[model samples]
Target: MNLTQSEIDLDLGAVTMSCTTDEVATVFAGLLREMRSAAPFIRPDERDALRQIMSHESGALTAGEVFPDFARGSDAHTTLRKLRTAQFIRPAGRDCWDTGEHIEIRPFARIVWDRLGEAGVFGDPPELEEDDIDLALPGADEPVEVALPAPAKARGTRSGAKWDEGDVLDFLNDEDTQG
Candidate 1:
């Protein structure tokens, strides 16, 4: 079944998840895990932005090498502002925001697109009748939304703290052992 935003919100609340830093961090870590599973490693800037994106559940495209889209802001601040107003993400630091429990990148984007399509953001499509074979297609007729790549900001270019592919893999596997 297609889960609506309201339904997602209710589910998050019911599950007792916090809309705070630790909660956001955990969710981001999870998304990173997914990315890592698919690839050797994620770029440092991408990791940071992905954390923000996942935390805020911002439907706005994320800027980075991995997920690129035209709908996102040119800078991190502007992106944060838009995300904050929408209540999708909250500020966690000077450059970070807590994505409320309700947001998940893929699912949230689908919901946003569905809502926007309903609101006529992209204009209307031809009406489909019951007999139209296209109506039974696996995916929705609406266009899939993609997160825009993050602009080449100075912060992203800064070196030293960036984690490479191997570093990320090691970090993920590192489970602190108690003596």
Candidate 2:
């Protein structure tokens, strides 16, 4: 019947292995907040590249795959190194950071993902083949169209009720009742 603030608070970090939506959202919110505060220090070119990565459904790619477009000549390598060092865009491999390995967007990068998703970040979904589409359950080829009964006009009444305002006059006007 009663609870303290600590009791109401959920310890998401303790059970991250469970991977619940609430826990994930909490993590994302924290990351977004940190990213916002750090935005002032983050370079414009790095920001553009990060936005592209977050928008990508795969959410990752090798430096070779993403570079050249985002970073213009000489300073590109230096900029990328800075980003990697700062952990803004991280390396996929534990041993090394290179063209062969992917640089993934952080799991909490949902802000960028949502923004890009709304702006057409992902391509159209793959079309299903005719055989792949299942219209109904097994052994049921055609969908059963259910026709609902017409709505009753009477207010404050339902079907199967012993008394209905709609039929009150009929009961009152019965010959036996009148007699």
Candidate 3:
């Protein structure tokens, strides 16, 4: 298949198999890098907050540790809400969020992370614990939209039965078989 310039730039691997162009792939890698770079030393409250976000979508998180005033501040609450709306996270259950849920990291977020990873933006993997996620907020009423990479151009030959060298060979071969 003839690849367009955009496709070429994106570095789509082979024609077969599910693959994303390099451009969008890089984006997802970047997000992962960012997550890794953030020191795992997030405040105990922050860890709890993240866990809560993860739990809501996946339906249940192991309970053990206690989080302090992670959800006390208005800004923190607002930020959590926004993140949930963006589909970056969601409330898990009774005061806990699930971070590992597939939906938490939207396709767009994945693309961003991929891009960042290509750029080598992450320093080291973060040592996050289970309590990093918190899930206290009520579920969001609106649906979250995760943007996908632009569709690839359709692949095919040019219009009209133009006679190329290969076409001529095949035509002759067919004629010989008929004779």
The list of candidate 1 runs beyond 4 A from truth reads: 1-63, 66-74, 88-110, 118-179
* Cα lDDT tens digits for candidate 3, 1-179: 22454353333466444344565457655655555455243444554555463444333332222233234345455545545443444454444332332224344434433454412323434646887854536656555553221121112333343445655566567668779
Q: Which of the two, 1 or 2, has more TM-score? A: 2
Model 2 per-residue lDDT tens digits across residues 1-179: 12222223445785534444556567756665565555555577766766676656543577767774344344555656655554456666754455555776554455455663512222325657977975656868655543222233134345555555545655456545559
Candidate 1 vs candidate 2: which has greater lDDT? 2
Candidate 2 residue spans exceeding 4 A from truth: 1-29, 69-74, 81-88, 115-179
Predicted model with the maximum lDDT: 2
Error of 3 at 17 (Å): 17
lDDT for predicted candidate 2 compared with the true structure? 0.54
| TM-scores of the models, in the order given | 0.21, 0.40, 0.28
Go through the candidates in order and give the C-alpha RMSD of each one to the true structure: 25.3, 17.0, 23.8
Candidates in order have lDDT scores of 0.41, 0.54, 0.44
lDDT of 1: 0.41
lDDT of 1 by residue, 1-179 (tens): 22232223224654853354455556655643443343223334533554556544344433432234323344544544443443334443334433322223455333434454422222337677888767456777666653222221232532334555655454345433321
